[model samples]
Target: MSVIWKGVFPAVTTKFNDNDEMDFAAFDKNIEAQLEAGAKGIIIGGSLGEASVLSDTEKIELLKQTVKTVNKRAYVILNIAEQTTKAALLCAENALKYGADGLMMLPPLRYLADKHETLEYFAAVAKSTPLPIMIYNNPYDYKIEVTLDMFEELSKYENIQAVKESTRDVSNVTRMINKFGDRFKLMTGVDTLALESIFMGAHGWVAGLVDAFPRETVAIFNLAKQGRHEEALKIYRWFLPVLELDIHPKLVQYIKLAETQTGLGTENVRAPRLPLVGEERTRILAIIDNAIANRPELPAGSWGVEA
Candidate 1:
């Protein structure tokens, strides 16, 4: 079955309580806000969602809850960021068993597998489950670049359907289109580069900041798709500072704090990843507050029209 992988899909954060347990109340509230704000899909257990820290039980429960909360209104994608092929396959199988509509998988976690190893690994997981896969090609963060040559090899798989292109090089968007055409549905993975990627013909955005400012994020994509570049840029210029938080080392904490300020969720994160403190916390809050204080009034119309 072909999944139409288009529109803004937020790499949502996993909410936790002060006691370090998954906070279902906050989690469900965030999901409802994203769906209500017209996000095309919700991605759970991603790097933004703190996948590395979450246990298998927690990951599975999150997937099940997201699938239940979305209830066919939007796609629920489970991010598989495991180290071994075996573990990756197991997660894929479990995601399917728990009702994930699709998956967004990174290359071999932490090992930085080479071209041949990466291709084989993705091919294995793609074959393990029938769910459509979005290959996350974020060389900047993951240190593994899924080159055009590797994509060519993986393209033979029927289920490897989309890519979250986050090389941080906007030109790579054109390069992928120039080479593969539509074999892989290209979704811009970086929050800051979203408008440029859309302008360059990317099919969608797997966004980060949308967790806090869903309407503006959706508005930028829809306006650009509608050829309203001026309107989109107006929002984009105002949105740039907050979007930068998505690329930071402390993105989970930063974004969660933004969520709290916006009344969407809490700033509570798991241990080893404490909440932002001191001046850093104050600075992030100021950025979010300034934007909120001067938040642009979105043009009146329906948003999130699929590209």
Candidate 2:
């Protein structure tokens, strides 16, 4: 089935063992938690998944393994952060062969292409693949903004179905809605801003913390979408401190640690990106521990459970 472009889509972390090999068992466990918690889709090999460090062959293997694990229970979307258009197209094409349900793609990796170049890059990729695509519009990390005007140009592509709205400007959600009005499904990419964006009009969340706190993450989206803001806010308030971790430079390590605490995975990261240590590690531990100790009791409803 094609992606509906709605609900929680966890940008899952890539699991690596002590020998620096892909741990498919651990990876499938995390994906299972997300699906059990009602995740609509799974985004593999994203920034949170250490996309920068993963080889293309590794990414394809991850997608293939995830497809085997999911068995069509939820959409399996591969993230493409390639530095060049050709590489991006190749990634998308490989995703197609592995039965990938969709894609969450970033702008050109290291290059800050101008509007025309950026638009053309997206068009070229979108034109190459038949899969539905969600433009990962995160300016803070990538340095290139996918402006509304550029989106206006991108809107012509039938396959460009959504935007991972990470601009952090809540008003941009409103502006996108006013300008395009459901032409694109808007899923907030920032963890802390999720409820705010949802209230404003984002269709779903491309969540980071969900990799660790799958049930809590899905509960917030479900409660809020049902117009249960007060209920969602209670959990969101308790969740704020840990959700803030997603915005940090060492987010992959931080979230992996959270996953470790939850028994979902480990903190093993690729080379050049070692595990956290010192006061920073202690400080992050305190935050994670506090959230775990004082974890909010989820209110009862459609998505309400501590599972």
Tell me, by lDDT, which candidate is best.
Answer: 2
lDDT of 2 by residue, 1-307 (tens): 3688889999999999999999998998999899988898899989899988998889889989999999988889999898899999999889999889999889898887999989989999999888999999989888999998999999999999999999888889999999999999999989999999999989999999999999999999999898888999999999999999999999999999999988899999999999999999999999999999998888776363321
lDDT of all predictions, in order shown? Answer: 0.90, 0.91
- For candidate 1, write residues 1-307 as lDDT tens digits: 4578888899999998888899989989988888877888899999989999999999989998888889999988999999999999999999889999899999999797888899999999998889999999988988999998888898899899999999999999899999988889999999989999999999999999999998889888888888888989999999999999988999999999999999988989888889888999999999999999989988755364453
Q: How high is the lDDT of residue 3 in model 1?
A: 70
Instruction: Tell me each candidate's RMSD, in Å, in order.
Output: 1.0, 1.7
**Which 10 residues in a row give candidate 2 its minimum summed lDDT?**
298-307
> For model 1, what is the C-alpha lDDT against the true structure?
0.90
TM-score of each: 0.98, 0.97
Clashing pairs in 2: none
